[model samples]
Target chain A: MANSSDKQNRLQRLWTWFWSPAAVLSVGFTLIAGFLAGILFWGGFHWSLEMTNTEEFCVSCHTMETNLGEYRETVHYNNHSGVRAICSDCHVPKEWQHKVQAKIVAVKDVYHEAIGSISTPEKYEERRLKMAAAVWKKMKASDSRECRNCHEFEYMDFTIQERRAAAEHQRAIDTGMTCIDCHQGIAHSLPTGYQEEYQKISEALGVPKLGEEMTFSEAKSDEIRTYLDQ
Target chain B: MLQILGMIGANMLSLPGILGLAFGMMTRKWGFAALGGALIGLLEALLFAKFDFSQIDAIEMVISILIGIIACLVGCAIRRKGVLI
Candidate 1:
């Protein structure tokens, strides 16, 4: 009889413990589990923004492959100074206002890609030149906003450079020299392939050929000035 | 098989939380501590999901790992101190 009574007491104690505050708290842990699951979902969405750094993302379209290939061969990629700027860094504007404008302009590129308008290499070159001219005009009007981000004019003595440049500019103006006649390779390094292309195009356009091999040297460059004067 | 492994690796973010819960259950500590760790792990995973592999390189990954390890160590130390108290 006493053994049966002790067993009943033990059962009652166990039942009470099951309904205790500790048991309720343990059940509440389920809500925490749900909250943790929510965080994992949030992190996954953030990963997509990182793809801009990858070469694949930059050259997913075949249209970019030529320029990207050229860029890879340039001093920017070769010197390993680790300061490499991709197409967007130079072409796109820095400020939010300009960024939105650039994005809006990019719609045309998407449309062109969709329509397969850029078929041959020649057509690609024409399209690229057109786009480059548009970008150059925008940058020039804005005093090269993207360039100024890295190369600040304030650091250089513009007064002395400007004076010298003005004298050269006036001489060029007097001699009817085109801007490219003097400052052909200001933004990018001059490639031999581009020089050959320039010669071909000049011949096709009925322009007089620059006889001597063109280089960055002052003596070689003075010949270009004299040629422009003629 | 490689693809399956990649998928499994990608989905392994929940492992830390599961391990934390298991540890709590084994030690008879506040079960909520384990739940909290799991919640933190989930939050970390969610935050990580927002960043694409291009944006978050190896450096960012290392920083995040360091953060997780430090948080876990701090939590464990506090728990140990609480037991002593």
Candidate 2:
């Protein structure tokens, strides 16, 4: 009983000191140690982050196997010059701050995987449009930052490019149109029904190319109605 | 586990607070439990919501923090009132 009492007292004393004002030095040392440990931890973590930027790591997730297969067919993956771009080159930012932000946003992808949101190719297809839209939106917002990392207008040898390609590039420069504006399918297959979706959006927003509404003649309208009914 | 915590923070309105309170009551350390809950809630919110102060809904965060504190106090009261469990 005496030994038990002594042990309890020692434990109580240690607890008191742990919570006491006198433990400021102890707290300071702990904080310093923790900070040092954090540096080591986050350093290793950042290294792992960069390693995951590889094509191999990116495709390790079966969710991306289809994308990887598609990517392999792209010029970015292989060409006469033999220079190649990996998954991170296009999908992740080059700069650290932006990369971290992208990764934070990407945590949702991890969460989706955890929740089995796209556990199969069919499931991925079901959400492909939404996913494509999200990537498009991000690229538009960033002015295709990732694409600019490699294909820059300043360095492009337009003279060597085909006339149409040169004209389009010049036009894009003149109009401030970014790479993703027209080049979304450069890496992956365009989601199914993309044209229909784009047309609906344009119609909803009253695209300027479309003139004022034209009314059909009663006979034409009746014919169209009959066609629709059929 | 961080993912789970993040999901919990994202999906539940008051579950984090309740969890903290329950932990506090069980451990008989309501204040520390509440603080821990607040930290977890805040971290989870930032991680899962992908929200910084510049992007977050301040009202929602305040509500989460308040929930933690209130639940902890309730837990403390329960402990003090002799329901030791």
Candidate 3:
């Protein structure tokens, strides 16, 4: 009981010191100054984060040329709605915790860039499968959280969707399948043997192989066009 | 593990509330406290909202502001009682 009382007294003293207004400068002035400094620091940090999230910053590296070209050809870059998903929108997590982790993990990309790991198109192609697998593995593990930031399953209007898409989406919901489970090459070109790589990644990540046999055949492509035409 | 860490990081956003409490304690003024809290809360909400007003958690924002106000009021009461440690 004496030890507990001593601990409480110590805490009380600490609290008193913390809130004391006995500094050389007026406590009010100090508090306001510190508060403004905090704002500036936070603003600068946020600005830096936003600056790095831009498409120009992402494609600044010549190694990203291939991805930029592929992404430009996708509907995400050029659609009737004129909506655009920049590199960060698809690659970065919107959640604060995940975003910080992603930013930290992304520092490795700079190291690779400095070393010219995939500086040329040929070198990029050689490592494309492995790189794609890594991203797929992350997406699988996170259940494609970044994708859901823009494409929420709960908000999807199945009535306006193509028959195949509607059917597949319903099936996915029923089976606990995620967006990345079937939409591997939506924004970028799939590397050769991506199917095998994806399979291995899913297995390694312990994600259920829900769409193991699913493939977008030519008939489904025709159906998609028909649905779009309507 | 990541989620837990993320939550702690997010809670750091409330650090600004201390400024409100300090202002009230030093000035013994409720108006200054309210203004400080409101401004801080607004800035924080806008920062996180990122132009998407729909994404703002109204309840969380309000609660943060309320907590700041309460802390400031408590600080003012303590200082008014001549408890300047």
Q: Estimate each model's TM-score.
A: 0.38, 0.55, 0.64
Off by over 4 Å in 3: A1-23, A209-230, B1-85
Candidate 2 CAPRI category: incorrect
Against the true structure, candidate 3 reaches a TM-score of 0.64
Candidate 3: deviation at residue B32, Å?
32
Per-model DockQ against the true two-chain complex: 0.02, 0.05, 0.10
In the range A186-220, model 2's lDDT, one tens digit per residue, is 77877877545433433453322223221212113
Q: How accurate locally, in lDDT, is each candidate?
A: 0.50, 0.65, 0.72
* Poorest 10 consecutive residues by lDDT, candidate 3 chain B: B4-13
Q: RMSD in angstroms, all models?
A: 19.5, 12.5, 10.9
Against the true chain A, what TM-score does chain A of candidate 1 give?
A: 0.48
Q: How well is candidate 2 docked (DockQ)?
A: 0.05
Rank the candidate models, highest TM-score first: 3, 2, 1
> How many pairs collide in each candidate, listed in order?
21, 0, 0
Of 1 and 3, the candidate ranking higher by TM-score: 3
Superposed on the true interface residues, model 1 gives a C-alpha RMSD in angstroms of 17.1
Please give the lDDT score at residue B43 for candidate 3: 60
| Candidate 3 C-alpha error for residue A106, in Å | 0.8
Q: Which regions of candidate 1 fall more than 4 Å away from where they truly are?
A: A1-55, A157-230, B1-85
Ten contiguous residues with the weakest lDDT in model 2 chain B? B3-12
